[model samples]
Target chain A: MSLESGLNQNKYLNLSSSWRYLTVENFDKITDEELVKLILENQENFLFLVRRYEEKLTRYIRRISGLDKEDIEDLLQDIFIKVYQNLNDFDTSLKFSSWIYRIAHNHAISNFRKSKARPVTVSMDEETEIARRIASGIDVLKEVDQKLKKKVVIDVLKKMDKNYKEVLILKFLEEKDYNEISDILQKPVGTIGTLINRAKKQFKKIVEKEKIDF
Target chain B: MSDLSKNVLEEIKEHHITPKPKWEFLVRDYVIWAMFGILVLIGSIAFSALIFMITNHDWDIYRNLGQSFWQFLLLSLPYFWIVLVIAFSIFAWYDLKKTRAGYRYTFTKIGLANIGLSILLGTAFFYSGIGMKIENIFADNMPFYRVIHPGRGITVWENPDKGLLVGEVTGFIDDEGFNLRDLKNQDWIVSALNSVWPREVKSNIGMIVRIIGKQTGKDTFQAIEVRPWMVNCDRNGAPAVQPCRSLDRERKPFIPFPLIPMPAK
Candidate 1:
């Protein structure tokens, strides 16, 4: 499938009915206290809480390790299981989002360590190779299309340090606020600002070395 | 295409690289949400049950179950919040990853957010649990029981004219007799005469004997009644009876013995 088509599919699938509902509702209206009380009073509604934060959490994890969908899904499951098992101790004083995000961070770090120890083949490479083969077999005129150029862009991004890549994605793609970024990373606001600055500079340098334009 | 322009286009493309999922994204999200719902349900039921047990004090099955429940709640509450925080944080990280946000950006944001959330939530749960425990403790109405003396036996006495006094041995009370000189300045002797009896001993010794028509003054010491402070005498020693520690040193040394009815003069 074309890269455009693939992204379209992802967008369609990720923006499920539940997600749409969450996105439409202003999350600020529902206080953390209310959410916690709901969890305590009716556990079933806790799913809403999970859904509320899942996308952001998943995005955070994916950026850190560059793990594919399967690994990310498995890790996400493990994290929830842990949260489920220990929900009784959740302190109502804290923001519910912050608590869950902390869990995500630790689990991601641990998962990264494990992934480093037990290396897995990059499935994206395989997919790209297959795409290349398919494209080579197609009409010669179409083989040198813009789609192929996009693939090359993806390939270069894959080679960048995971840290630099994450900053770019969150800033340009996710459009998250600096405060939100700071909260997710457990860093001071100043530190996040600094990291973003450094990341942009490093990214620019990398592209320049590759003789690529801004 | 000019080399410079081509390079520029390539860089922009690289910067805009998007994530491609390997699985059906809808199904994954559904499964996660479903699982979360189930977990919350189970947790709520368990939490309610715990609250019920604590509030009702339905520990008839085992006499000590009530105490055990409080202990378990105290020990487990902190750990529960911590685990929840960690798990949710991981979930956030995974979400960030799937979106292909850069590692530094995603992790920094998610990590800080999660930690803050966990601490806030955990603290709230802990305080609530603690509050419940305090309420339970008071509700039990077990009586503020304390042992004034632990080991050597103490004899409680009441002089009707005075109030109440407890006497514990200095040196061992030999079969022959207690040596007055050796007992004079001993800690036990000094402590016993002065200290307030355990809270369990509500009535002064004089009152107990007075009801029996015991004479006051001379018969005061003999009229006094003494008992072990703790329920399980075999396990815990008698509570030490000492003057109120907060009192002035001179005042603390002498607990006025209650006057009993005087014997026929």
Candidate 2:
């Protein structure tokens, strides 16, 4: 059967009454390796795997999503579809989570490029102080309303380059390490470090230009 | 760092986009499949190796090959892998910089293929080298030795036992004498006394010692040479044994003797 037809047939089989009994509990006891084997044996059961990592996957997606809600959803859906199609080719030696995150990062960056958004530059000096203030839980936020402050940050991020934006989002929002971001971006650890440093600077510049009350 | 810039961090966290359900599902599925493939690949390799060893009565060949493979690996494996990764990264970076039209299509295909080929070749080379070492080197006589004492901290030749100092136990020397098993875990400190030693000394010791060949006695304590350990010095004035200073005055001083480079270096 054609690949598309095979997928449709598999999905139908998955939704059939016979498959309804295949619950999360059934696979919970199995090791990841064994669970994968089961999924390979029955492609229809792949949906369970989807449910398992949904929270983490969503968090990752959220980090790269732009300000536009619809665009974010569309990009996320596209990433998932790609993941579904590539399931059979997945390598099990690597952590299943990291591999998926890599895909998500790639997809998000690609979507960002297609949208052709202008690169945003935020001042490093200002952003660093802002970052410190946020980290220190100081009175900086007291001056500006929380919602308005958030809008300012989001607007500034939207204007930044996808590279900078992704790193900032992953680091600040998702709280991923430099190493994790490096893996996701497939960039060297050193390069990621430098990018993060520069990203913060650019972010600061943008924040200053906007003159959002800190 | 200013207070305003720091506030941006909190703002970013508060304004995180809500991930769509469909995308979340897709990401999860991809992860599962990727993990499955990797596990299968590793399992297949290990299984094949095991089967090959069991079927072949001549296990000696495998042993020798493994030794040679390990030697080469120790000498060059880390450097090789690092170079390969750096080279690939450079290529990827250049490709990305030169093209604006999403080189992902070509880049991913070529990059994956290159990586796959490199891994396959590396594994083949490793196994083949192991086989060669087993057949040639391992089959021959394997010299062993003992370490009388492991020096305190990083200090070389701190306490020397006055006695005959044998061939320096190279590679890894534990607190006890050089045992064959120690080779498994630690790299040895080369002997400082025997400058003429042929095979590489791979163990560390408290003092220089004259190896009287393998000790047959039951007692673990054996007497060996101690102080005034042969300190081999290079043109740079750095001693081969303990407390060797570098020719460049700016560089930090090192201990002389024992032929082992300082770990801090």
Candidate 3:
């Protein structure tokens, strides 16, 4: 078959109702790398990959940027488009999830710059969980109730430098390990460790500056 | 698929923006490394020029400039080359930070590394005589260099208080003195009674020599040291006889002085 006819046949096979229950490799069992290879062969299959990431990435963009629904939608489209265009450059050794998050982080940071927004805060539920996580890590904040601690942490994060604040968000809100944070920030794991420690110190200092009786 | 996914996929289909070619990144990396290499080369040249100027300066000949040792150094030091070294080092620091793995190091670390590397390579270049050749090129080409470098030029020896004089030996008066014609062709009796000659120099008639001593008479000088008046020679071993106006030529003060008759004679 000519290349166009072959592509059309693949499209036909993909759209047929039999594809949902087909004997081919299952979507759940296939690795993201394998999915990427399949997508390269037929661009229409990229929708499956996009659907997998859309909800998680949408929430991630919202939490990191605090942009409105429309802006988040626009950024989500841009990030996915960027992911598609640069799919060839992805390193197979890294987890594809980390690479996607890295792209998202970069795009959101750029959006923040464009909008001239300084504050990146988590939702209340996320803040409460992150505050609990911080309390578990640092003993001093452990005594406070989850709500009060979350409020204090949010206040402190709002006032901190972007470098420190981002590490805190990645560590507590996103619950990412040092290596994943390193990949996202393009820094060494040791630097991520240092940044987290420094961020904790700055968090405490900001808490003190605000005269919070923690 | 969700509407968001469908819309994004449709946009990708319409725009068809592909990843940049791998060669573009390779080209970028090559250009960055090339820039770094050029900076290092320029920095090496600047640093070696600095080392050459320092080592080749006549530290022992301060009396010829009518100044104390420190004063002569302050006046004649090659500040231009030193400034060039600093500028190149800064450029190296800025350029190096843009390289892969360069941002991992602190700015001070990068700056110090640049200086340390330059100095190490500069030492090698110094030993290889690239530094000396570069300094010589500047000294020979830039006439104004003597104005900034005080210890250069025959004018330094003209100060009677400095106990330095350049003259051609017209005839030996005796074991203690000689009738000499200064560069300006003025006749003077040079008293070499207590003069020291580190090397045995043939005091042939018509030979030019520099006498470092004090003036004790209207037409006489008391010599403390006597040395041959060396003219700079070119790569072909031929004398590069600079015109009298050229003040920045670098020459050893101890080479054999050729027997050239005084111009006025």
Candidate 4:
């Protein structure tokens, strides 16, 4: 079957020859699932998915691995390629963002394993947001200015265990809820709550142990 | 417009790819969950076997081990089953993490949940007889088990210095003493004037008891301490709450004699 006619007939993309007129603005109009369905028929449509996740995944990899831009790009390319290659296998039950993040998480971990170096903190631009989430009720980091507080958070995250660090990043930095974190990490919600609690405790302990400047 | 996006786009064009098939992911998910279920089952079975070992142990056999009741208990504990339960709990924790949402939970939470789930299932297994049957099968077949198995006349009783006796309270001699029948069906007279009772003592007829003291004669002993034979006092047999060693310390030595009412001196 012709690709355009097939997509139109299947109601997958709900578009046909008119797809040629699709613009960067129109890309955001379509859902990820719909895009995946469209891409299945016309491989060129994969660029839409690529555009959607590229920058987010890039930043995610950098925050988690502290890899250089070049390495992050290489990893991002690999992750996108992986996502494209596995699009047909994507479980519809999960949110598309979560599935993509899961892929990114797995790729970053495997990359870390091969390199055998611990992840370091390289940026704190999002410090204000992270600080707000992490220091929600705790007044320990409250008096510190945004920059120092961010520095403190980064230092503590760098020193903590990988599990604690990942949960902190996902919850506070990524702003993922318990259920979304659960889906991305593939663990039960109860366990996610437990990890976040433990992660907070570990973070506090590290901050106390290191005696970071206020 | 970024060069990296352009590069990724070119790469995509050069190598046409497709997502992995849906069935492969389905198979992977199901396989992980299947493994998790199996681990939970194994953990529960191990726990049930441990419960069976403790619940069904022959307390009367400690009298034959030629050791203090506490020593015999410490030695006969089901270490093998206990280790298996711990190992299986860890495995269950790992396996559960691999499930769709397994990574979100902390290690402590997963470990505790694993144990709690296994015990829940273990209870069913224990009640259904799988736990007891496995233990019986091991005792009946394995040679090593014979060494720890509690029964009548096991060679462990060859020594006569144990000084510990467990039996039924047949009669009350006085406030400081009682008549008893040891596990071996032998008769004995006990004097507990120098002993202490950590918990309340029931001298009701047919009540089982554990006595720690010196053998004063062929059928008599100077009781250093006395306790209810089994702790938690249920109709069905349960392990003793306090064995000899702890009870030995609980006993207050050199208390004033004539614990029973007596005529004025």
Best by DockQ: 4
Fnat for each predicted structure, in order: 0.00, 0.00, 0.45, 0.67
i-RMS for every candidate: 18.0, 16.1, 4.5, 4.4
All models, RMSD in angstroms: 20.9, 21.0, 8.3, 12.3
Residue-wise C-alpha lDDT for candidate 4, range A1-214, written one tens digit per residue:
5433432443434455446334455668767777777777766677677778888888788778888888899988898888888887777888899899989998888888888876776366655566567766345556554344666776776777887778777887788888888787776778788788887788677767887765
DockQ of each: 0.02, 0.02, 0.32, 0.34
Query: What is the C-alpha lDDT profile of model 4 across B1-265, one tens digit per residue?
Result: 5666666667876775556678888899899888888988988988887887776455655654556888877877888788888898888788887776567667888788888899999988877767765765665555455454432222232222566666777887667777887646788887877687533454465666666667888888776667664334433333332221122221212223335555555
Please give the C-alpha DockQ score of model 3: 0.32
- Where is model 4 more than 4 Å wrong at Cα? A1-12, A15-24, A88-93, A124-138, A144-173, A185-214, B1-6, B9-13, B60-69, B104-117, B120-129, B136-153, B156-265
True contacts kept of 2: 0.00
Error of 1 at A115 (Å): 2.9
RMSD of 3: 8.3
Deviation (Å) of B37 in candidate 2 = 26
B52-72 in candidate 1: lDDT tens per residue?
233322222121222365564
Off by over 4 Å in 3: A1-60, A87-102, A142-149, A176-183, A186-194, B59-77, B132-160, B164-265
Ranking by TM-score: 3, 4, 2, 1
Q: Report how far residue A58 has shifted in candidate 4, in Å.
A: 1.8
User: Against the unseen true structure, what C-alpha lDDT does each candidate score?
Assistant: 0.41, 0.43, 0.69, 0.70
